[model samples]
Target chain A: MKANLTIISILAILFSSCYKDKGNYDYAALNKLEIKDKNGVINISIIFGDTLRLSPEITQTTAQNEENLTFEWMVFDNSPASSYALPKTVIATTRNLAVQITEPPFVLSQNYRLTYKVTDKRTGVSSFLFYNLTIINKYAQGWIFLEDKGGAGDFSMLLPNGTVEYNVYSSLNSAAPMSKPVKLEITPFQITDDMSPSSKKIYLLTETDGMEVSYQTMQKKFNYGFLFYAAPQIIKPTRHTWVSTSTSATLSGSLGVVVNDGKVHTNLVGGFPGSKKWGASLLSPAGNLNYITAPFVAGGTTYTAAVYDVLNKRFYSVGNTVLSAFPSTASTVFDMNNVGMDLLYLDSANVVREYNAVFKDETNTPYLLKFKTVSTTGAPNLTLLKTQMNAPDIVNMTAAASSTLTPHIYYGVGNKLYRYETTSNTTFPQFTFPAGETVTKLKFSRQPLGTSQLAAVTWTGTESKVYFFDVSNVGDFTTYTNVYSGFARIVDLGYKVP
Target chain B: MRSYIYYFLLLTAILAACGKDNRVMYKEDPRIYFSKFATNPDSTDYSFGVKPVGLLTDTAYLTFRIMGTAVDKDREIKVTIADSSKAKAGYHYNLGPLVMPANAYEVRVPVYLYRKPGLKDSIVTIDFTIEESKDFKPGYNDKPGLNVYDRLHYKISLNDQLLKPASWDSRLALSFGVYSKTKFNFMIVTTGKTDWNSTIFPGDQNFLIQTVKLSLYNYEQANGPMLDENGVRVVFP
Candidate 1:
């Protein structure tokens, strides 16, 4: 009984010591700050490279004189903190924040924590207002049109919302102008030694030069010479193509083929965050004869690309380090080593392992040759259909593009567009432009996850315009989706996707 | 009152155990060993065959790292050739003065090798050992299970005959084609590079090939066709 009484007495004493104490003290309330945009919202979104202007309505309950308070605006990357410290940038010291957002754009919209601190110099008290900011890339998703203005050229972007951003290349790369544009290529995912993780790369090819630019800023990354283990003697680059196959769920292995001076060079497209340089000129080792190849190449996931040798009028397969001739087989549909015709256009057809090539004989007769670049057993199989085109306007076609989802080849003659079915050897007239308008280039969107749309550029005497047509599963132009005008003779167009 | 004393004693013990630990974990003596590069930890090899015929001597550097903290005073390192070495120290090679500067964790020792007449017909190897000095003692030995070699020892081979580069077949062959001694010598003369290794970038390889191709064309135009040691017509792929 005595022990219990003693414990209870101690507990009572402790409870008595924890009693709230009210003392005579003088206290002052802190300055309360409220910050908001004109729409009364604290969170905002802006595009990369655009100026961010925020004249928030800041209210302080305790401070009436603006000169007695100082303001500071700071921004921090809202990504989860890593082992290394994250960077915090002080953007402005004035009450109104105005600064250019030059930070790198992420693949997705990046979140940033914007903080506005208002300090009262009199009492050394401060108030803070926080904002959630999102930054988006201007070049995230669009159609890049290369405009050729005589010898000098520029690039324009046709956004999905029917808006055109003209001369985007010149606006971004003012000092480094593009000239004699040849081709435009977009690498959905590219990793280099200097870039961590992966990034999208845009390749701008010209007659005498080749350049790689950032997909986000359109800023030049490197020139054509940097693309090779050793650049060729001639600087005439005709085409650069990339083909990749997923090696794992999160990793892909790619191969790059560059055709310069009518010679083919190849390299492993990208390393897992490493640099890959093109190898030597791929030529037949059996002969000491000089070789010249066509500009167009058909690439596949088998780490090999097919190029047509113009001098010998034959097809050659280029691997990582060697150029090899397709094995001659009597059962083959056509002799790969003796096509005997000049290759006009060569591209991968919609079917897997199948390629469509258009060739013209000396008599001006156009022939459509459809063959599998590689067979199921990893051997060259030229056993598919090969027939002479019966369409009268086929020989007059100047531009050609192949579909990826259907075995259809879209060709342009003057101002008319036609689709040729390789399986049925039939041609169908798709569309016709106004008088004096001539088709200059034709391309199909090659984005892996994008819709199958055919993009055609036409020069209408005074200006150039691009037309997008939605393609049906039956290889027909179902609808005219969009059209963008006001370009300077667009030479090539490619779809850029995040 | 007794329970209060017990509570106070327990709190005192908990606070006493919160003191910082200052235990030493490293040995007091400083040690040094031959450092291995991240790219290549094995012994290095050199050949005068890649150099111009007129060149007679070249220098190679062997690096050493210390296992202790850097000091503010310069120290001398002692190096000696193994008794079983095939190359004579004074006749075929000479060791430069070895000095590790103050506040440095690593130092490079230069070995000057000569193109002796015997080296043209036969390869010579010099095995080096790091000896104890006033500042440092020989450090890590071989760890066979870990595939690591002795850090206290290093070896270098010297030859005057044209030897094929390691990357000849896998990398250079595609650009330069077949490999031959005469072709390699001509490439050295054309590119003026004595250090041809596997680490050449693709762009550099292309540049080298282009440079040599042009030079080869010029040479053949001036002097019929160049032939290799086997009498094969030298050609670039």
Candidate 2:
């Protein structure tokens, strides 16, 4: 009882101390930060490689003084405000704030907020001024065609202004000659978390050396959550033959990179998974990841997805579960595209897959082979559909209506377009490109709201031509319109919705 | 300690309530009916055209299904033909009687729609209804996917190939490239009359593509592509 009374006395004393008010004081600054730029707002527009200089005037009341005050001018990409200890966000804290827009973090048509913060050394109070700059580029929107100058790759942008700029990468990065650019992937043309404007992100995955340009940008911000390395986390990936990215069925809204590889990995970067790739969970058998490489194609629904392994000659796709391996008999998995449930990959046989709801995903969905040699009635020559896809001339596939409903995938065989039927394992010869020209790349420009325009780059001995066709009709090359001509060898083509 | 035990029990009860209760109670027997998808094989109108040079006929089968329980006794239901001016039963076509046998949830009725010139100057509907039977009453009716005709009654017109129904274009079947007759016929029978209208967008086309494409047609029983009116394999590209 005596011990309990002693504890009660201590509790009463603590409660009384909590109610006590030592003193009340207002240490907030009598100062205001003012920044002056081009317009009323402190927002300026700067193109790539353009220098920005700003000297803002600070206003203060009679109570405030300039002595014993410190000024910090920092640059950040949408990072929250902070006080006390400075975040490693000092882009340029040198003698004077002269931003040398030489590298990335300086992406075209993007907004970067510049913070001019002032702190009173005595009061420990800070005032910050946020100013943003819209990074602009002459070749901002439209189709970007990548060219391979031997092993070193360069890109040309077909601007909305109807002019194709020859070397866009060279103007921004002087080291572009050294880095071998393999494939370039941009964030999906959808509304992202930060409502970031389109064309703000363009990831140029290269072949080794310095990460200087992109590395410095990533330190301050996570743009579109997309990261590329000739060497990424865990298994370093590069020199991939085929690459595709789509919204992950496993991780909603997030984009996953599927590559035809010695090891197929979807854990690269983007929305659903910020930095962590969700592909490692797909491993059931040891080294099963090796069987799935390259030629990753997106199926409409998660149920009809096709991830073909050219090396193992198998399919590693996702169903209700992240299926590590489905011993698919499909021998030659051709270009996999998704228009509803249309299967793009065909063996030597061009067999059709019936995306049975019972068996979602591309694996084990009933298959049909309508070949001249095979009978469609009995067992459908399951062995043949797995072994061969009939159109031998099929070098590449470009889907009409990119990511649109009722889209059509045109299989470019030599010069003819073989339209594949997902439900019936058959291909109908649609239209053919002009003579002496082989399609180097087939692409589609995504129009806003599920609309798409089809375009293809064809090459011959000395020239490459880009042709535009109406993808409005699922598979019809008859609507062909010549977009551009006379380029060396078109390596890759990416279209921004105009 | 006693209060904590009570709280844990309450939480456990709430969790139990949230769990899936697949337990179905036949509180008085829930009724059944012929499925709307079951009303038409491919959910397409029974269409045909008389060949001028050759004598031809087609007999497509429509399915009968019980919605509630499978009975042990054989049940025969009466079907009354809709007496319209365009169609006469003995003149244009012959439809066999429908019977649900012992312990069966499904059965097929042969709806023989024929096109003999002078049977009718134009297309005609061979509409019918499942009258109440001694063994079973009208099982269950109101369904979402069923067309207006199939929901309350079963109807198929003796439509000519040239005068096919306008509804065929917007069908869920078109998503699977069934713009032609043979593909349509193949889609229906191969699917075994599963409802497509209700589950079109997210629905599985696998059974139709994978299994049905490989199955021999009940009427043709051939192992090749289904050709269109042009005599070429129907390629809707």
Candidate 3:
């Protein structure tokens, strides 16, 4: 009880002293202004000016003046003030003051004002000033087309709302896109075709009434008004053969690519009036019409395929070489050297060997068929690679190059795909696609109980469905979770309800 | 020593008198009550307050008063309706004049607490047999329809292929020979709709589907059904 009395006595003494008058003084200030824009957004910055003596009562001692200065800043108006600190701002002790006005919408050509005030604490006097600002709008605006027209085959572009416009090439150069692009207005189109096929170029035109038009030259009896729907279709060219006078025909095969024993085989579609044809060619022992050789030029090279020769230790390709021997029928030729192939199948080299499929890139730049190394293991590892004829777009691959080594890969080149073998280390034996042709669709399939096979599909006309057998399994791969299939036409859209 | 003791006693009395002044100036006695003291699930936020029409009527209110002494200690004063049987889940307004003398002040706000039934109108009420005081009288006022649930919403998708003959005419022709029929898997889904059986959960509902068949004769009878008038007569021939 006695201790409590002592504490109460001390508190009583302290309370009386709290009300003592120490003299009246006021110290406050508002300062500098700054403005900034972030992508058409505006912001403001302000800094407090140096302390000023507003009254005569303040000490004028030069040496003590600096240490005695103090200031408090505030924002006033209908706007509520905040204690949030701005950049470079600090508790004022003379040369302190800065504030930032965050970005907010402003009238395009309206003037805004910020008010500031300052008071001398020692003298109890104050002064005020206001700064005015104006805001201006900057101009930034262009149209962009998503699809380019130079590449082989036809494809459609889709708008954000799912409207589609088909793209068909009439020639290498055209000012405006063909106004008669196929109209795919239904729900997102689905690929009814089961496999990949060959690629062909079809000229598209718009009639006077805006209907999609393609040459129906396939009829035995050519006549006008032969109505047929230009269904989106993929065709694969298996081989090139001379039809009647001035006509070349292609046999159509499956619409996908496949892989077997590490060798690559693709389904090819043959075409007339440019039809997709399916066939295979290997050189016979005789070196006439079957083997052709020429100096490997940097450009103008076409048709690359892998052909295994059971008779020789090497492989044959229709590249950088003339026909050494010709076969009258579609026979499996087994002699590699007779066909003028410089390099045969190297059983242990698991490196990708590419063939030039198309001659030019989107910029019309010539490209080459070159193979870099990919993954390799076990004896006789194989690597079959396909690059987009004119680009480096590569896909549907197997057995990558060793992780330690990076392959100089290309895109949008022949096929934009490849097949590599882990056992033979070579491209599969097969015939090549004709010049100016591309394998747009490469799909692989396996029956529920039958052996797995490669299907190659290609786009031939404005609308052509073609399929082929992929001797070289390239594109079109199926896994437990995903099945990659090609559509007759460029798939406009796809959606599935849960 | 005796004189020193007296001096200390005098100082102690002065300090005690000052402390008493502080305590007496800050007394706390808070009271709360609802204007309408009944517990009902259909209660709205404003229902507890007296209505304008009842201005002259003597209204009985449930008063919750809290009395305190000296220092302000945190306390909970709960005002619950003893008739738990009629209790339902809903919004209720608690009324308060909440006044005290200048020395008596409140440090915290008063709150109301009540439990809600899981199902709508599912709680069965047991009559309050407990007798009411002779001076007490139950309050009465107008009542509004309780919005048990918002209007039900329906999503309908029609498939003509599945709705063929009965649900729809595929060909849309009134001739028997030309009559074409298709079927559709009509799916009718409902949400926020009233469940007559109250089998559905409080806010969830299931979808329903019913298939029907259509024929040319029936289509003609309704409006030149699947069979035209002439075709309908030809069938008799």
- For this target, which candidate reaches the highest lDDT against the unseen true structure? 1
Residue-by-residue lDDT tens digits, candidate 1, B1-237: 776665576567657889999997966678888887534444767998777789999898888888888899998888788887899988889988788889999988788999999988898989888899988888777642322357888888899888888768887787888999899989988777876753665545554665676567668768988999999999887
> TM-score, B chain, candidate 3?
0.18
**Each prediction's DockQ against the real complex:** 0.17, 0.01, 0.00
Best by DockQ: 1
Error of 2 at B186 (Å): 59
Sort candidate 3 into its docking category: incorrect
Query: For each candidate, what TM-score against the reference?
Result: 0.76, 0.38, 0.19
The candidates' interface RMSDs, in order, read: 5.7, 19.8, 28.9
lDDT of 2 at A52: 76
Ranking by TM-score: 1, 2, 3
- Tens-place lDDT per residue, model 3, A77-181, is 211122234322222223333433323322222334433334446554444434443332210000001121332223432222333334322231243333322
Cα lDDT tens digits, model 2, B165-200, are: 354567644445546656555556555553333333
Let me know the DockQ for model 1: 0.17
True contacts kept of each: 0.07, 0.00, 0.00
For candidate 2 chain A, which ten residues in a row score worst on lDDT?
Answer: A351-360
Residue pairs in candidate 1 whose N, alpha carbon or C atoms collide under 3 angstroms: A229-B202, A229-B203, A230-B203, A230-B206, A230-B207
Q: How would you class the docking of model 2?
A: incorrect
Assess candidate 2 and give its TM-score to the true structure. Answer: 0.38
